[model samples]
Target: MPKAGRRRSAVWACFTENTASGKRRVLCLFCHHDLVANPIRMVRHIVRQCPNADEHHKKICREYQALTVPARRRPVVGGQATEAAKSADALELESARVHSDASAPPTE
Candidate 1:
């Protein structure tokens, strides 16, 4: 058991195939879709699979991303995510998407 003031880590490795090299990639907890690795992968995932992803999982991912550095920086796991965090995450994600689309370059 961990002592008081000390916490457990939530990071887990998810093995995925690298798009370019066809090699195995080990992903950390923070990078669920690997958008950080290759921006194009982020676009593809958002287009094809993410739309069909379960709502609950999407909520969790949003909450995890929107979580502030200080709050999430502390390692912990298995506890309920804060409702405030969930709501904030949803709003932030929506805003970000809107801004991104608005600023994107147009193609002929």
Candidate 2:
């Protein structure tokens, strides 16, 4: 499925494509390296994980990280994703959307 509105789109902005397994995926803006689409993708790429992340990724990462960083880490498998992380991210995105929707008038 497509993401929600602006809040989710910030995380989606890092994406390049989706896998056959129904997971939307992202490539490092600095290196075009592929990974699952999530906020931690920003944190991992901006921090220690991605060797190619640079200034561009840093700004995007920071923006998305503020919206979606989970409080804990999920086990990673060869840099691949798991369902738990996806669900947590979904929850975060939903939470952000609900909060925004309640606090502001509908844009259109």
Candidate 3:
């Protein structure tokens, strides 16, 4: 299907299912090239030409590398943690609350 709005010009892509995550993502096959052309042809062009298209790919690679630092994580500027960490922390809080309530004395 044709993409809508601004992204309408962006390329359409289907990510192969990740074996570990079992999730898929859509992406632009071409580097910095929008999906303005015919969908099937666009997909083909992206596969064949996007990797070496221009400086945009280089920038994307640099950004991706920066985001994947293992030694240190980015500071939570607004207290927003990654989704996985947030879910685990929520579970811990829930368990603590349950235990506290369960162990407390009964009241009239």
Q: Per-residue alpha-carbon lDDT of model 2 for 1-108, expressed as tens digits?
A: 988677555545544664654777666665667777766655666555667666676677676666666567688777865667667777788799999889997686
**Candidate 3 Cα RMSD (Å):** 13.9
Task: Estimate TM-scores for all models.
Answer: 0.26, 0.40, 0.25
Among the numbered candidates, top TM-score falls to 2
TM-score quality measure for candidate 1:
0.26
Stretches of candidate 3 exceeding 4 Å from the true structure? 1-34, 37-86
lDDT of 1 by residue, 1-107 (tens): 65788342222112243555455433322344543443233333433455455455455444444452234443334584444545677778879999999999987
Ranking by lDDT: 2, 3, 1
Q: Candidate 3's error at 106, in angstroms?
A: 0.6
Model 1 lDDT, full chain set: 0.45
Better of 1 and 3 by lDDT: 3
Q: Whose lDDT is greatest here? A: 2
TM-score of 3: 0.25
lDDT for model 3 comes to 0.48
Give the deviation of candidate 2 from the true structure as CA RMSD.
18.2
lDDT against the true structure, per candidate, is 0.45, 0.66, 0.48
Kindly list the per-residue Cα lDDT of model 3 for residues 20-103, writing each as its tens digit: 434332334333444333544444454455665445544544444444434455455567775444567787997899999999
